[model samples]
Target: MDAVARVRWAQVGAGGHVARRTSAWWERLVAAREGRAPQRLVHAVLEVVVDGSVRSVDMAPTWGRSAGARRVVVTGPVGSRLLGWWPLFRYELRVVDAPAPPDHVLHVSDDLPLPADVLDDLALVPALTWGRDEAGAGDMWTSNSVVSWLLERHGVTSVGPPAGHRAPGWDAGRCVARR
Candidate 1:
């Protein structure tokens, strides 16, 4: 609205962009634990496919820079946090194929309806959900409440309950289909 306010706003915007581009949690955690710093995060486009048709594209997290992470935590609300709910979905990532995701994600699977925590701990690399919400790309997500915030592109979302919920564990594998 004012000159000073505009300058402050621009500064804040630039800082936010810098933070997002920094190494993802997994990269920092693994590199620190191993007594080294990761050179970069591997960015990959998750292509959910079935019947040879591209179904969806989940931009996933900034941590996408790393390959071979078998486990990743999808965050959600944990009851009330005095102010209604937690501020930001604290997404914790564990590459069991790296180690330790629970300590960061906070909530555990024992409390939720699904074994989401464990599934994330033992998930296969490049996993996915069943498929399209069918309401068209715009409204297909069951509950994009959080993902709408994390996705770096166009504020994305997908089927609710995270991919691990419908995964049926690492053995059954994941799926991808378009409407």
Candidate 2:
């Protein structure tokens, strides 16, 4: 890394209750739409930061099934491009204006901000996944994986698939879990 090298990460806010509740609502809505029994709920909160300092936090539901629900769209390069432009997309933590690269950070107690793109595409699943993967919060991988599988099964070409894990992820091979 050089002096010009920079990195972007997601911010987990201390106030993410609203987003969590909203995510749970949307999860049920999607489950109902898919004719599946809703079991667990999900939420989304977006936090943007720079140099280990808080910038902004927004907490809200990720999905809006109702007509009046707000929509948020996030579009960025896929694959390796993400490595260079991680900050462009929603992440668990982001540091845009750091003088030096992040050496090692810890997940401290914090509030969760609202997700960036709550409507349209590139939301909910990815945002929640980030929350799970990076923030060590939200167990949304199974639900998100199921959503992607169902979408692909029905030939829905609106959103892409989830990253990591196989088709079922933790949802499958676990009888105690619900889909």
Candidate 3:
């Protein structure tokens, strides 16, 4: 196998209009209670380069069945007859080629020299309950949790939200990954 070239991460605005607005409002409320100014809300995604090919890793809602080969797992209350019936309640871990990150990207981390083993572990992230505070990290699991979980699994701990910004559920991922 060719040596792994590079790994980097991008912090982007939440994908949908509703998600963006809701995240902003929630963060604002939390910040206000803590006596700090609200930080810009963001989500994390990874871009990995190997043998000159770029692959993006992220978790997203299973809106449809078109994820094709990129979808790794569909997780969340799949056994519950209520939530299992709706795609909105399920999420997928995806590794897509030549990914197009959402608009309004907030920050991009410097490239990290990661080992190839980390890529092999991408599909192995635990299928934790999404949108639920399963880790007791004080926040619900979301895409940010997935990214942080993968990073933590490989001992990459310093990557985080940029200055004056926040990525909710980040700590939750790390918390769960550590167990």
Candidate 4:
């Protein structure tokens, strides 16, 4: 990574649980730099729109700091809420089409309500679970189910600790390449 290249991460759902994890990592990244190393910042670039206007921008707090970002990690829904935060992050979102070093990681649950066409448009694949166990249905992905499906299909690696792990400030785990 370039010294000046800011680690860019984007969260689609800022209000969700996964968004909190992403934000925690961003905050930690910023602290690690301490004005010396390159900055690692997340953004709420995409918006989730249902009717017509904006709905939510899950990763808005990330845009307040660090300016250089190269990748987007979507976790929640993208609708009208997210549209409002687009100006903060001017970088275009790149959807990973295959197994690769994911710029971001998303949550994949079974309960979220997303249109079939939208899911098809993104070409998402189920993270694949052996049915709910002790963790119950919620034990699945930590972020939005829609984002999780897209990530699993494209083979993008997730950063930071798993949904519930160590302190909020830290990468879940090194980028995991599927194939």
Highest lDDT: give the candidate number: 3
Task: Show the lowest summed lDDT stretch of 10 residues, model 3.
Answer: 2-11
lDDT of each: 0.25, 0.30, 0.70, 0.30
lDDT of 3 by residue, 60-120 (tens): 7678657465746445543233685688767767777777655667667777667655667
Q: What is the overall TM-score of model 1 with all chains considered together? A: 0.24
Q: Give the per-residue lDDT digits (tens) of candidate 2, residues 1-179.
A: 10111112212221376754765576568668879865443212222343344332222233332323222333222223345255433222221121332222222224323233211123323333322322232233333332332233333333321222122222321221222
Q: Which pairs clash (backbone N, Cα, C closer than 3 Å) in model 3?
A: none
Where in model 1 is the C-alpha error above 4 Å? 1-16, 19-21, 24-33, 57-87, 90-179
Residue 107, model 2: lDDT of 21
RMSD of 1: 20.4
Candidate 2 structure, TM-score to reference: 0.24
TM-score of each: 0.24, 0.24, 0.81, 0.21
lDDT of 1: 0.25
Of 1 and 3, the candidate ahead on TM-score is 3
lDDT of 1 at 68: 59
- Between candidates 1 and 2, the one scoring higher on lDDT is 2
lDDT of 3: 0.70
